[model samples]
Target chain A: MKAQSDNLVEAALETLKASTLRVTEPRRALLRLLAEAEKPLSCEEIRARSEGEFDLVTVYRNMEVFREQNIVQTILLESGKQLFELTVEGDHHHHIICRSCHRTLRLELCFGGELERYASSRGFKQLEHKIEVFGLCETCSED
Target chain B: MKAQSDNLVEAALETLKASTLRVTEPRRALLRLLAEAEKPLSCEEIRARSEGEFDLVTVYRNMEVFREQNIVQTILLESGKQLFELTVEGDHHHHIICRSCHRTLRLELCFGGELERYASSRGFKQLEHKIEVFGLCETCSED
Candidate 1:
């Protein structure tokens, strides 16, 4: 696990360099956190998990930079919350979030190609799709 | 068009009563706006179109009430903004928004049923899906 994590950090650092972004400590740490996260995390969730290492505004600023560099992607939930995750190349995916617990799960399924084609047919160009599924997790449903 | 709009207001009033919410002028005007709209609107957009009739804080408060009653649904965009639209029964749909013009068009196509089944197979219950397609409109693309 440690070795895998190290590789993730290494790759993230390379990503920053490739995007011509300065590799600051906070940026490195935020990248590692997103890279290692099981699911996309909101700004608040990221701050809480950072253990006081980073302030909220700093995190938000770094996230905006990361977004511009395509190092991270933002996922918007129906609840008007934004979640961020590392943008791994060749691994396009979506998310399924538990409405009760707000736990997000990565989804491998993608139908963007077809959806994009449909949008293009309708005279829309540069199509990007956001697909989010909300549900009750097993524990929440049981409760 | 006038008759259709009148029916929309009537339906909206009925919706408010059905939810046991008090019908007021501001609420009625807001509902009329949503009913006549071509797409989901953000609070800022709503205020701008209100022609200085509704205060920003009053709009926010009324929106909260509308959401609680399920009269209006919120759509979160990748830009970290929230959009609101009326919730019409049995007419489930999504949207394709132009990032440049911020114009939204109703998408009649839906694949939520298939997605819900997939989530159920993965142990998720009470699944709801949100799909938003973003891009440039024809005019915006030409520009």
Candidate 2:
């Protein structure tokens, strides 16, 4: 697991360099966390998982920069919380989140092509869409 | 325009009464604003439109109560802002927002039934989904 995590960190570092973002400790830690995470994480979740390494305000600022650089994408949930995940090249997907536990499961679906075409026909350019499904996951339902 | 707005306020009052929420001055005004809005309004927009009749904190608190009572629904934007809209009976829609100007357009298309069925098959109960599209609108693109 540690080796795999290290490999993920290396990939994150390469991404940062490609985007011309500085290699700060907090940025490195956040990128690694997002890269290795099984699901998208909110700012609070990211800070909590950092084990007191980074502050909430710093996480918010870094996330803003990462978003501007396309290093990460934000997933907007129905409950109005924003979650972040690494934006690996050619790895597009949607998310299904458990409302009770906040557990997110990635769905490898890309039905946005039709939606994009529709938006384009309506004179919208550079169209992007986000779809988030909410429900009770297995563990939460069982509980 | 005055007559139309008055009608909308009546509808909002009815909704509030149906949801068992008190028809307070701020609540009534907020609901009326949402009812007459062409697109979702953020808290800042709401406050600005209120013209000092409602304070920022009062708007926030009223929004929370409205949300709990299902009198209003929140639309999450990619910019991490939550916009409020009236939750009228049988009125369902999504949104497409302009990235530059933050203008929002209502989309009557709802393609969530199939996705909801799929999620149910996967053992997810009480499934709900939110879809938001982002792009440059005509004015923004022209600019």
Error of 1 at A66 (Å): 2.1
What docking class should model 1 receive? medium
lDDT of 2 by residue, A1-143 (tens): 77866776787677678876779999888888887887888999999999989789999999998887777888877666788888866778888888998887776555688777767777889789988788998778886
Candidate 1 residue-wise lDDT, A5-85, digit = tens? 667678778877887678898987887788778778888888888887989998999889887777788887666678898
Tens digits of lDDT, candidate 2, B1-143: 76866775787677668876778888777877877787788899999998989799999888888777676778887767788887766878788888898888776677788778767777888787888889998888986
Candidate 1 ranges with C-alpha deviation above 4 Å: none
* Cα deviation of B61, candidate 2, in Å: 3.0
Error of 2 at B91 (Å): 3.6
My TM-score estimates for the predictions, one after another, are 0.86, 0.81
lDDT of 1 at A48: 83
lDDT of 1: 0.83
